[model samples]
Structure formats: structure tokens, C-alpha cells
Target: MPFASRRPRSYASPRALPSARARARHGRNGRSPVTGPDLPLAHTRLDAFEATVQATADYLQDLWPDELAALRIEVLPMPDQPPGVSGVARWRVIPQHRLVVLYRIPIERMSRLHREDDWHRRLMVESCVFRAVGELIGKDPWDLAPDRFRHW
Candidate 1:
């Protein structure tokens, strides 16, 4: 009679999921016992993009200490481009200020080449920023950035 009415309970939110320490103590599987995979909700891609730009900026500042004041960093939604050709800007460099204009959408699109990997997406953003700076200064981006800066 006691066992007749008994039923298993369930957890609604992932927050109720067991912690690593708890799991280890109980000696359960690494993943959630009920759920197949332990995958949780993902964070925003905007935060990731911001972190990439900040990292790239820090690297550039380290590379060129004195010249940092002269160059400007601009983040725009998308680069001004012709319908088919995106090589929109005709002017070689800004007459007064050297600028690196990073178009978020275009770079994010390029980052889709390796959808799952974060390093690839970040590298794309960094490389795009480097390329923009190179265009402003009229130097090859490879020459400006370390060989390790290559993106997938």
C-alpha cells in the first residue's frame, strides 16, 4: 500500500540540477541523470563580441604604446558598401584621423565559418580589426599583426 501511490519527482529548472560536488559525492554520472546532456542555456553573443574587441585593443596597445593616441577605433553595425561589392570606401585613409572601423554584422557573418568554436569567431573579429587598421596605415595586415593572428 505504501509503494502503490509512490511516483518519481522532477525538477523544472536547470538551477535545481545537481552541482559537481554533489554529483561526485553521490557518485552519479557526469551529466544530469534525467536529462541526456548537461547542456545549459547559452549566454549572449554580444558579450563575446565585446570581450574579443577588448582583447584585441589590449594587444594593439601593448604592441604600439605611443601611437595609440593617434589611431581611433570605431564599431558600426555594418560597413557602407555597394549592393554587390562591399569594398565601399574609396578613400585610402581618413585625412585627419587613422581609423579602424569594425562592422559587427559582416565580421559576425564571417565568424559563422566555424559556428561552434569561440576561438575562431574571436580571431575573425581581431583579424578584421587588424585589417581595418592596416588599410588606414597602408600596410599589409600580416605585417602589422603577428602570424599567430590568422583566423579560420
Candidate 2:
């Protein structure tokens, strides 16, 4: 029989929805697609470094609770070098601003030597922050809290 309208008829099927794996792989409509277990996202260099600094600072605060209010940790893209030599980190011990600044680029360069292993990079950043903070506070990092860092 001839159809009255020119439009094609729609057909319903059993497989109306995408499979679970498909849905997981490609999110709803055009957002960032989610990778499967084979892949994972990593934090950017600056973010990871900042986190490392924060973690170390928290560790310090736990030991020296009274001193937490006096110290500040800062991260800068690059150090204020005399000319061509951008150093790893610096500290400025002012009245209200006892700041220990970590230079991102130099430290990233140091991290790259470890082939981008997150744990190694985190340790590197924390160590850098620890030494700088210790310098600003006039205490040896090993002596910051000897009992807390026996392995270190």
C-alpha cells in the first residue's frame, strides 16, 4: 500500500541504548571522554609541586604546631636570578612574611630527571620545601622533627 506521507517510518529495536563500556568510554554528548583503566590523568607540574609543598608543610605543622602561624610557603614560576642562572628555591624572612619560595621551572627540571614518577617528583618537591623552610626557621631539616623522620 502507498503511504499518505513522504516521511520514512521509524523502527524500534532491542538494542536502543549504548552498551556500558561505550557509555563509560564516551561520556554524554561531547565532554572530555573518560579513559578506560589503561589510561589515567596526572596533575600538572605546578599543581603537584604545590601539593607536595602543602603536604610537607602539614607534616611540619603537626610537629611544631605553634610555629605554623608564622611560616608561609610560596611557589614562583622562576627564581629572581642575577642573570641567566635560575636557582632552585629562595627564602625571604621578613617581619610578618617569612616566605620560602620554590622556583617551579628549576624544580621541574630536577623532577624530570626521575622520568616523571609521581612519588619521586613529590618527594623531590617536598625535600626542596623542607630544606628552604628549615633554612628560614634556622633549623636543620633532619632536626625539624627527628622522631617523625627517622628514615629520612
Q: Given candidate 2, what's the lDDT at residue 54?
A: 77
Tell me the alpha-carbon RMSD of every candidate: 15.4, 17.1
Which candidate has the top score in TM-score?
Answer: 2
Q: Which 10-residue window in model 2 sums to the lowest lDDT?
A: 1-10
lDDT of 2 by residue, 122-144 (tens): 77777776777677777898888
* Ten contiguous residues minimizing lDDT sum, candidate 1: 1-10
Stretches of candidate 2 off by over 4 Å are: 1-42, 84-96, 111-116
User: How would you encode candidate 1's per-residue C-alpha lDDT over 1-152 as one tens digit per residue?
Assistant: 01111133456635765677866766755644453466664556765775677677667667766655466665556656658874543222463656555666667864546455787777777877676666766667787656564676
